[model samples]
Target: MTSVPHVPVVVVGGGQAGLSTSYWLKSRGIEHLVFERRTAAHVWETTRWDTFCLVTPNWQCRLPGHPYDGPDPDGFMKKDEIVAYVKGFVAKVAPPIREGVSVERAFRRGDGVFEVKTSEGDVTCDEIVVATGGYSDPIIPRMAERLPEMIVQMHSEQYRRPEALPEGAVLVVGSGQSGAQIAEDLHLAGRKVHLAVGPAPRCARFYRGRDVVTWLADMGYYEMTVDSHPLREGVRDNTNHYVTGRDGGRDIDLRRFAREGMELYGVLDDFRDGELRFRPNLAESLDFADRTYNGINAAIDKHIAQAGVEAPPPSVYEPVWRPDAERTALPLDGSGISAIVWCIGFTPNFRWLDAPVFNGAGRPAHRRGITECRGVSFIGLPWLNTWGSGRFGAVGDDAEHVVSTIAARLEGAAPAIQAAE
Candidate 1:
């Protein structure tokens, strides 16, 4: 039997969130062991793509005392730029990260510690933070199982570029950010792409001349406390933050794709023969449902009109939405579609974490990322706080809090995080 290594804290991922946590722990004079599935540079390098860019603007990519004080503050950071930024973060604050240690299982040892069993060996820690993000697993709906064996299919995670796709039409599912962008990309690549949009609120790729993130910050949207406001609750409950990227920018938003030969349908109903079917009357249903969203925009327009706030002409950033009643279907070979790409968003992965702290949703039931369960905590969750908890600008706050909690617990006091815990 191999002996399990022991440590003060064990962070189970080496991504942006995990690195941030480790960085803060090191700064606070905390001893930690970071078990990463891959090497430091290779992890970020694998996630990189030609068109990959952060939706969060450069200025917002701040982690603790370190912020992205690059040349371009307003613009988004490309994949290489982000990788370089993270590399700089690691170098400046050298955290003890162990690469190539893929965790196989994690369960509480009952002595206020966690026993993390990895492929290489095992380790024990006073605390564990599962920083692996939601996108680790790609989920294909059950309907996909019935599709014809000849049909080509791939999820957004597998798609690197338009050139990788087989030459033919495409069907993209899940109208969220990823789905919308992939559908738009395939269509732009001269492949007939049909998008199956679920019931979701549409957002402009940008508002005015500035990025939508700027407007969201200015309007107190990001600042809204998750506990106090219903809209904030809805934003947190329904979906993750939606900051549009270059792939779905104002010039080539989802609505433009609909106008440019990319058919937009409702939810995917079923697949039979060589045909893919969907709900009905997708267009008319969307029009009716959009009336509600139009009301909100009209209110904004009315305010602008009343305030005499003259703005530049509108860009191609029109709204995109789907009505609940609309159920349209489409045939696969009928549209000449050769592949199906699922761009649906991600969910957190907690499979290795076998602790009893998980809530009904399978997320660690920590109070603001601080574990109520002994010897366990969560970090890097989306929108963990109002000021910032999940974003690059916000991750440092959560990391600091988790570190403090660990310190306080060691001191035999209640885990009192000075900030964001």
Candidate 2:
């Protein structure tokens, strides 16, 4: 029988997080292999819309040693540019990777060695970094099945451009970052848009003088960990504040979209008998979003004042539009809505891990990124170290932490991390 190929370490993703770990591992002269079920930066290349760009500025695109040295550091990278940047990192680190291979399962054997079952073959390793991150599997609500078959339905990931959609009015459900930005994408292309606003908060793109992200980073918001947060892990489920780095960056104001003739509704409640129903909360949801937007500005203002930094005068957002009345229901049979875009976020799927590190909901349970399971851990998850863990900005830090934990184990000096339960 042919023996399975083995390595000291195996990283199970090819995205920035996994490659970041690979970079550190290589620096330490640790032999490892990366298994990417698809090509490098697969989601950024295949799933992103044509006009998709990073909501965060390019300066935060730090991948271990290879930070963003692009000409447009403050600018958001478009889809193609983003893909190139990731591929560039892959080239620089030159991680030992098999692009088409998939890690189908991972578990620790009784011997303390790890077994990684992959699509192509199996491998044994002393340690494995589950860097696949939290997001997997595009989610479409079951309510979509009730909609008329003729109306085109696609997840936000599948949406490329407005013109590509069916020629008629479009209804975008769930006003999170993706939902709001996609609505803007369609609205800019002159498509009549109806947006279903959720409870997702909104934030300003630029504050007093500089980008709000810059202010937050300067104020140490990125370093705040889950344990330090008042809400603790509850903050993990909170939808991201919707803003845009498109066209030099700006706030994604759904109310402003409504003022500009796009129709806005409250959270979608149900679809019954060819009619879509919405809760009577459009006004409330919009108000909450604006409050969060201005709230962030207020925090930034306080930071500026305390730090004695010169900046433009503080300002608050005033509502530009309000719903005349709560829109309760709309019949789709004759409603000009020809396309429905589901912008609801993805559901977490980590079933392949088959490890004791997961919680009841199947989410990986860890202190920072270190799990109690010997020689097994996770990285690149939201709140893995801080709010920035799930994004390009703080992934480097998380990767470094996970790699350090792994190194400590290799040296038989794993300390506080190994004791995490």
Total clashing pairs in model 2:
0
What's the lDDT for candidate 2? 0.87
Predictions in order: lDDT: 0.68, 0.87
**Model 1 lDDT per residue over 232-318, tens place:** 434455543223466434433455566677777877777876566777756653453355344434544554566676665443323
TM-score of each: 0.86, 0.96
lDDT of 2 by residue, 189-277 (tens): 99999999999999999888799989999998887888888888887888898989999999898878888989999888899977899
The residue pairs found clashing in candidate 1 are 134-347, 276-332, 278-328, 278-329, 279-327, 279-328, 280-327, 280-328
Question: Which predicted model would earn the best lDDT?
Answer: 2
Model 2 spans with C-alpha error above 4 angstroms: 418-421
Given candidate 1, what's the lDDT at residue 374? 66
